[model samples]
Target: MKTHRLVQNFSGYRALICALPERSTEALAPTLKKLGLQSELIGHSPAAPVVLPFENINADRDILFIDGDMTLPMDWRCLRGAGRSALPPAPVVGLVGIEAPSRLKALLLLGATAFLAKPVYGGAVYSALFLGVNEYNRKEILVDAVDVLYEKRRRRAVVIKAVVSLMNIRNIDEDVAYDLLRKESMRARLSIEDYCEYMLGLRQEQDKNENAHGERQALKG
Candidate 1:
């Protein structure tokens, strides 16, 4: 079954060109408008692109046109880059210069899904936007899958500890303990891993109280 919905036409889509508000943006704007996308220019300082607030940007519809002339905002550590296992908050198109290794690397780190040459042209806008948006969507799917697998692997040992603790405390067999935990997890509206962690904490507190009570009785005797 085909589940994915493709973004066919750009109607009411918003784009931000992250660079100096110069002639390039002036040329780019009218082309974007014709395509039914609202475009704006975003200028970054000589220092970094951190001043370009990512929080204001939308993940699905926003597109970034990052100029390769200056350094990217490393301060935006949460920003996804080219080689990362995750996608950036939005798709990015790089505006290139002489194409030096360092300059290209900066664009890669900003997670530029597509590239557009300097002296932006009207003909190239639709193609760049098409590639950038689609490529980013593909990467996001793969990244999300990897994250789910990693979390499951990390919690495997915790699952064992939780199961063993349940068996000992409840004086039940391993299978029974696991089933009980599973049922309780459903009741609590939690994942099995989360419920197990919660149970473990309760077990620790119960042990402390029992030990304290035993000591009090012994002292009195």
Candidate 2:
């Protein structure tokens, strides 16, 4: 009833699940049906970012969650009231079990509202989803400077164009890219936004060096 009530106002509301075999998906059947949400199964691998079909996530029925291997780029508390405002902010019910304080702080800075640990039960799942929906419905949507900073930093045209041109293109968002980079870097806890800023700085430095080299060559000529 809670899920239905939440979805009733939205058109074609759906939930996509990226779950592991170890964690059976059968338990989510009832919740899916109650919410009229579509479900999909993805193999569990830490190497993969939780891949939800973005086409399914739009203005209509836009609420979404990346249930596995999702690490935040900043403190999620900064994202309070994101969904209701004109900016994008759907509630994220994260599942972080015994995470490091640094990891938790990063998630909080990114504005995550709830933490649903692993080995979840029916009640815990229900509570997190229902409460997220309730909070979403009650608030005014608004994204802050930090969110904007993340968005702008993450979606550079050159990077997006490069990604778009790639035959194996995955998520184009920079936050997604940053997370992947951190995963590959073997860092303990790197916020996507923070990681992006560092990478961007590196790129700028490279460009500056190239420009200086060009100037030197012209002088030699």
Cα lDDT tens digits for candidate 1, 68-129: 87454545456664445766778888887558998888788778888987678889888888
TM-score of 2: 0.42
Off by over 4 Å in 2: 1-12, 24-26, 42-49, 68-89, 142-221
Q: Cα RMSDs of all predictions?
A: 4.5, 18.5
**Local lDDT at 131 for model 1:** 85
Poorest stretch of ten by lDDT in candidate 1:
1-10
Measured with C-alpha atoms, the lDDT of residue 18 in candidate 2 is 43
Per-residue lDDT value at 35 in model 1:
92
For residues 40-93, write the lDDT of model 2, one tens digit per residue: 554456555444444444433544443434442323233343343332245555
Query: How high is the CA lDDT of each candidate model?
Result: 0.78, 0.51
- What are the models' TM-scores? 0.72, 0.42
| Model 2: lowest-lDDT 10 consecutive positions | 1-10
